[model samples]
Target: MSKDPDLELVKRFKEEGSLESFRALYERYKDKVFSTAFAICGNYAEAADVSQETFFLIYRKIKRFSFKSRFSTWVYRLTVNVAVEKRRSRKEFLALSEIGEEVFEHTGDTPLETLERTERDALLNRSLRHLSPKLRTVIVLRYFQGLSYEEISSILGISMGTVKSRLFRAHRELSPLLQRPPFSAPPGGQEDAWQGN
Candidate 1:
């Protein structure tokens, strides 16, 4: 028996053509797919479109999903590929400013603190917007998705060294922009600290 928690569901969907299994998978990954799409495409509407299309493609291709990689990794790769293609075809891209609302939530704070936090969030969003897609992808996968370097390399189909280099570049670019103490990696288990949810 495969140790992958989702393997049984995937097998049911792939072999028995079970819609229930597929729906289960969809429920599990919808938010992740949408977030990755939004992070890459940088537009809510476009991300929604990408998410829908990604699921459609997954439904069609699940039969071909080899067990060589984790199902989640394969899904992320599909999402990233779709988002990148969509981005490349478009003439302009928007900054994912909505990310600030989703990521940073300061409740029960003084008005002054709230304002300062908002400004900081805005600065971070703008800084992220300035990074190239390649660099931004590394940042999103590492910090936003809380993926490991090995997982990122697998998802992006890049070498571990390449993933590290891109992350280094992204951090360097964002640091000056987020000045006031400069941007740094979040502590372990706090990967979602930026994400107030």
Candidate 2:
């Protein structure tokens, strides 16, 4: 496998405590971290807070990072944990309606298609809010974040079997709520992506 692109930068920051290296890593992952946090927390402000807290924790704990996993995987796992913690503190579950632009591609569809897609995406976002955090995380990690089963398993610290099972359950729960075809996976993602290994 190819080396993780961030490995050198991570090494620089971890070994030399280079502020520039840390900034580079931050710029690289900031959007992804914020997007993952928003998908989980649903509120932009809370997601921003989660993103901030995530990097803060990373800054303080970088020296302890075991290189057992890819650096990006570690960052994603940290982001998910922080987002989950933030969600636990809030009473209301918010919908990710604002993320439509990020979640769906702009394929230059007709005006009617655009409107329909927007409405459908809104429904899907609202439906997602009804799912428990555990189920939601799998959906966000797999479909929203476009992560593979193995990557998700690693990020969640769960077995691949458990990851597949949770995705199955999430699909079952979402089908009725959608009241249409199940939500599509991320662009370029296969329909069989969720199937058994």
Task: Give TM-scores for every candidate, taking all chains together and pairing residue i with residue i.
Answer: 0.82, 0.81
lDDT, candidates in the order shown = 0.83, 0.83
State the lDDT of candidate 1 residue by residue for 145-166, as single tens digits.
8988988999999999999999
Question: How much RMSD separates candidate 1 from the native structure?
Answer: 7.7
Superposition TM-score, candidate 2 onto the true structure: 0.81
Clashing pairs in 1: none
Per-model RMSD to reference: 7.7, 8.2
What's model 2's lDDT at 55? 98
TM-score of 1: 0.82
